[model samples]
Each structure stands twice: as structure tokens, then as C-alpha cells.
Target: MNRKEANQPSPISRRLFFSYAGTSALTATLVLSGCKDDESGMPVDMGVDLGSGDIGVLNYAYALEQLEAAFYTQVIQTKYSGITAEEEQILTDLRDHEVAHRDFFKAALGSAAIANLEVDFSKVDFTNRTSVLSTAKTFEDLGVSAYNGAGQLLTDPNLLLIAGKIVSVEARHAAAIRSLINPKSADFSGDDVVDTNGLDGQMLPDKVLMLASPFVKTKINASNLPTP
Candidate 1:
């Protein structure tokens, strides 16, 4: 759906669009369908040299999706109070999209994809509405910056296009959630999401995770992520 008519899901629900006809979900399922792998054995190598090409870019996307998926999954498992049905559905959709993103990269990358990241959400008060959304806002914004920053690093045109589509959707999500924070904040393109002079902001994976580390109790080593 277009942004104007985009249906807003409640804080508890997910507000995202998914097409079953698309193969991203299929690819994701295929990627995670095999035997379980250990995080220790696989290691959290954000800079695993994804192969010095598009493979690296795909792997990068996969890593971020893993984090996003983990966070949303936790949110749903321990839902907060004062959550509306609409919000619940939105969060669910958000969770599904993150899952699809995680799976999409996993399937697309095949063996190149990293292992599931164990997130630590000990700092987030799932019972508190503000804490949850604030962290959610950070994630959404980081995802947007990440795609924007990393998109240039992608060697393949098709992969770049795919990342564009996904980041656009993420920007929409960032906008919607900001509205809930404060109506005036809904224009995500404003200083909140964007930077001075209306330029898009950038955040390295390390910095992004450091911001996220507060809520996540899991120890992540993004030191290996490829850099420009």
C-alpha cells in the first residue's frame, strides 16, 4: 500500500506489507531449514569479509536482520501493557517482516550467512511502553541508515535495488513509530531521522550495536563487519 493509505498497526501489532507471491520468504525458509548451528562455532563476525564482493553485502544484511528479528521476537513474547489491538498487529507484522528479512538474506547468501545472533534484552522494560518504542525507534532508524550506508558497498545492481525497496519500507516504519512518540515527530525525514541540512544520517554497525547494546543482554562482536 502507498504511504498515504498505509494502514497503521497498533503499538502491539506490526504494520508492514508482505506478498506471499514473493520468493523472499521462500528463500528465507530454505536458508534456515537445515540443521541447527551453534553461535559459538559460527562466531558473530560482522566483518567476516563476506567474500570481498556482493556476497559480503548480502551477509551484512543478514547480520542486521538477525538482530532486528531477535528484538521484535522478544517484544512479542513479552508484550507490554496499554497495547492496542492495532499496535499488536503492527508489531506482529514488524516481527514477520524482520523474520522475512533475516530469512531472505540467509537464503540468498546460503552458507555465507552468519549464525543466529543471541540478543540480550535485559535493559528493556517490556512492560513499559516508552522504553519498548524508544528502542524500536532506534532500531528502525539504524536499519535505515545501515541500508543507506551499506547500499553503496553492494557490488550488484539487483542487490542494491532490493535493499532500496526494503529500506524504503523501513523508513515508512520509522515514520509511523515516531508519530506515536509525538505527533510532531511523525515526519521521520525531519531532524529526528535525518540530519542537519536534510541529509541522511549515517551510523556504523559498531555504533548502532553500541546504542542497541543497552537493551540487549547478549554479547555481540560486530568487529568483523566489512568497512569501506
Candidate 2:
């Protein structure tokens, strides 16, 4: 399942890159801090439940997109201190990209997409720079791994290509954020996350959901993943 056409994106800049990274880090901090505290939530509505099999996998990706979209939205709304012009711009771009991904999945899933996911990140400290950047690094890294691991399981080349393109960007985000934190901690793409054949590792959907469970309130059923 894939879409046929889309708008084109404008060129990006070096300064813009840095700006996006800082702003994104700032946003992750906010979510990690407040999402956990906000008890207000809407009733689960719209789309299809992630049935077992391939449908479950799509729902898994959608769930992740929801979390990411929420995180970026909060970051842009309440930015961290010491943010520069370049950082602001790039963060804006990333926010837009995440929003696009979220909406794309929502549209594609039609009746198969799961309900709105509630996220809680109350344990994080937004004021602290390290915590924000580190958390961002984790999300980016996990996203890359998730896409990589899920690739082979995807039989549709179109879907595979879509996942592949997105994961590369996720890896880029991971690298940029990791540099901010330590200038050298972007190695989350290790053998563990990458299988023995030097291919991107594939984590079962259940395991991926478990890693994401801290933020999402609902449990996922991956019993539907196709048996290879």
C-alpha cells in the first residue's frame, strides 16, 4: 500500500540542518517532561484497528508516527533556551516532515489505522539540555532500527522503498542529534540493531511496541505479522 503523487520539497541548508536538530532536541525534552503529566485525552476515534498480519505492521508504524508528530508539535510550541535562527528553521522543517508522515499514514490506512495514541513523557527534564538531546537520539535511533528491521518483512517494494527512504532520514536525524550530545555518539546503528549479514536488523513488532509502550497507553497485537 502506497500513494501515487506528492508535492516537492525545497532545498535545505547547513545552518538549517543545525537549527532543526536543536529545536527537535528541545521538543523531545518538552514531551518527555509533560506528556507524562497531561492526563487530558480524547476518546479513541477514527481509522481501522491494526488487525493481525500486515495490517498490524502498518498500524505499528502509524503509532510511531503519532508519537513523533506529538513530540515535534510540542517542541515547536515550547522551545528550549539557547536556540538559534538556524536551529529554529530546521526544527520547523522536521516538524513539518513528521506531520506529513503522520497524515500520510492516517490517509493511507483509511479504515485500518488505529485510534489516536496517548503519550506520557513526564519523567524527562526539558530544562536540561543533555536530557533533551539524549532522548531525541534514542527516538531517532529507534526509528531507524524499526524501519530497518521491518524492511525485509515488507513484501511490497513500494512500501519497502517508502520505509527505506524514511529510515535514512531518521538515521540522519539520529546522527545530527547525537553530535549535539557528544559529537560522537551516533553509533546506535551497531550490529545489534543491524543483523549478522550486515543488513538492517528486524525487530518483531511486539518488541518494537514494548519499547514504545512507555509512551503509549495501549498494547499492540502483532500476532498478524506474516510468517516468512
Candidate 3:
């Protein structure tokens, strides 16, 4: 059956995490939020659809890239306490890279691109190093997982190649953040995230959205995105 047809209206306080196989080898554990219908029991606007098929996948990437860019931009703006010059420079570079990524997706999607999302950083404490680095780590890891999970959903070879390129960069970002948290060791490829076969973590759009929504003021309706 079409997975989209299986979606049901959700309550404001209720959410779902679905672990299911997609069109190919990649598996997804989606974090679905918001109600599918209104009081009239009719289909309500679920915000941005992210479309369907390959275009939906690109918009998905674009949304996360935008979040990462916004996050790094804020980090650079405040500069956590006792941050070294090297750390500052590296973070600035990360910020630039995220912006480039965000813009790349925006350009690639063109008219099909979703609108610029507003971020909610109210929960983040920018004054503390530990807090900032932890958040960065979370975001990077999420990015890597998101790309991995969404990969097989894209039927377009060129789009998949582009995704491959972006996922590599995201993995690097994840490693860098992990290194910062543990300077003496290479926990970047730790067993917790990477499998024994040497695969990075993967997450469905719903799962990613749950982790990311706290930082984003905008409500995202990702239910309309294509499933495997």
C-alpha cells in the first residue's frame, strides 16, 4: 500500500516514530507531529509538504542545511566563553560551509524550494561552551543520519550523487564536533553511532524533525514527503 495513505491525523500532544523500510535498502524512523485534519475532519494545512519524489528529498536536505546554517551563524555571533582562536576559526569555517550548503539547495530547488524557515534557539544557551558544542554535535549527527536515510528515496542518479557529496561533508562536521567533545580520542567513528560494518547512523524525516523542531519556530509538515 502507499505509505502516504497510511498516515492519520495526530493530536497536538501526540507524536509517532515509524521504523519502516523505504523504496530501497535505507530504513526510516520518522518523527511525525501535528494533526492531519482539523475540527471539521477535513485535511488541514500541514505547513510545507516537501513535495513528493526526488524534489521532496531535495527540499528535505535544504531544510536541514538551513537549520545548520542558522545554528552556526548564531554560534559565531556570540562566541562562547574561553573559546580559542583556533576553535573560533574552525567554527567560522563551519558556518560558511553550512551557508554554502543551504544556498546550494536553495538554488538547486529553485521555484520548488520551500520558504526560509524561522529558527527557535530559545532553549540553547550560547554563553556556555559545553552547551554550544553539544548542540553542534547533535545537529551534525542529525544531518548525517538524515542524508543517509533519505538517500534511497531519490530515484534521480544526479540528485543521489549530490546527496552523497553533502552527506560526506556532514559526516566530517559530525567528526569535528565529536573530536571537540573528546580531544584525546577518535570517538568520531565510535560504535554508538557507526556500525561494526562501518556505517554511520541513519534517521527518518520524522525522527529528525522531532530533534530539530525545538530549535525551529516554524512548524514543518513533512508527512507529504515520499516514502520508500
Candidate 4:
């Protein structure tokens, strides 16, 4: 789809989108079907379902990794003017990691994987070091939290193992971004993100989607994902 067409706002919020869809008495079969919101609701352009069960969770991770990959790809494409050599190298590594993670999910899901998601980076100024690092920090932190929160929803032991490995990598990325922003700061395990018990922050799928909505061009219905 064209940029304008892809970027248009969806009529329904992610929270209500799949929740209502599930209750519609429609066929339980999951597929990449699109539908519009009812006339009474906000005119959200409906996107495909993330599907149900473990595959849905994989799609969710894939979607977020896609965003991270896209963001880092953009950052490297147009390096910020004052970016240090260390910053460039680390950002390049981050880009590579995100791309690998994205591809890994795609490979694992095969036919079940979601389509390439459109990402909107209009709010970011790629040429500005501060802006880029700040945004990177935000994404890395969000990614770690997303995986932590979704861990309980994964039924497959293998999937949980894979997720654990990926979350550690994302945590390292977050620390690196934090260090870039503040050279004197502790890189990993930030006080803001970790509690007195030293546990990292966590966020539910709905909350993650809400925070992630702006960057994604394609609407996602994640009501089918497992919750606590």
C-alpha cells in the first residue's frame, strides 16, 4: 500500500478490536482476514488477526522486532552528525541483532508469520544523536519488558527457551542505549527499570500494544493472545 494509505488511522483501538471480533459469533478459524469497525465505533482500518495460541504470541514478537529492526535500519542509513565511532558500531550491532531476531521469528513461523508491517518513523529525527539514542532506549526497554510479560503466555517449552535468550539480548541492547545517552550511567540493570529485588520491568500484551501502536502502520488484533 501507498504510504498515505498505509499510515491512515484505524477505526478501532487494538484493545477493543479483537475482543469484539471474538464475541461476534464468527467462525473460530483464524486467518488473515480484514474487516472494518462497526459504523458506531471510531472508523479504524482493520488489520489481519495475529491468529490464536502460540503462533499468535510469535506474531506479536515478530511485529515488535520488525519495528526495532526498521528503526535501527533507519538510524544506520542516515547517521546522526555527532554520532561517535563507538555509537555507530553499537548501533550497527543493534541493527544486526534486531534483523536476526526478526528473521528468526519469520523462519520459525514460516506460513504463519505475519506480513511485513509498515512502520512510521516521522517523530524521529535520525540526524540528531540525542533523539536517536532516546528512541533506541525506549524501544530496547519496551522489547525487554514485552518478552518478560509474555513469558507466562508461552505454552511451548522451546518457545520459552528461545524467548529467554532473546530477552537477554534485548536487555543488553537497552543497557547499551542507556550508556550511550549518559556515559556515566550503569549500562545494564537501570534503577528505573529494575526494582529493589533487581527484577526487570514487565508489561502485559495489551499495554505493550498500546505503547507500540503509533510506530506500526498495520493494525493488529491481539485479543487472542494468552493472558494471566
Q: What overall lDDT goes with each candidate model?
A: 0.65, 0.59, 0.76, 0.79
Scored by TM-score, the top model is: 4
Which portions of model 4 miss their true places by more than 4 Å? 1-30, 36-45
What local lDDT score does residue 148 receive in model 3, on the 0 to 100 scale?
95
Specify the poorest-scoring 10-residue window by lDDT in model 2: 26-35
Comparing 2 with 4 on lDDT, the higher-scoring candidate is 4
Candidate with best lDDT: 4
Estimate the lDDT of model 2. Answer: 0.59
Better of 2 and 4 by TM-score: 4
The TM-score obtained by model 1 is 0.71
Better of 1 and 2 by TM-score: 1
The best-first sequence of candidates by TM-score reads 4, 3, 1, 2
lDDT by residue (174-220, candidate 2, tens digit) is 66665566546645455545567866555656677778778666554
Give the lowest summed-lDDT range of ten residues in model 3.
12-21
In order of lDDT, best first, we have 4, 3, 1, 2
Model 4 has an lDDT value of: 0.79
lDDT of 1 by residue, 21-61 (tens): 23342233112212324666764323223343555556666
TM-score of each: 0.71, 0.69, 0.81, 0.83
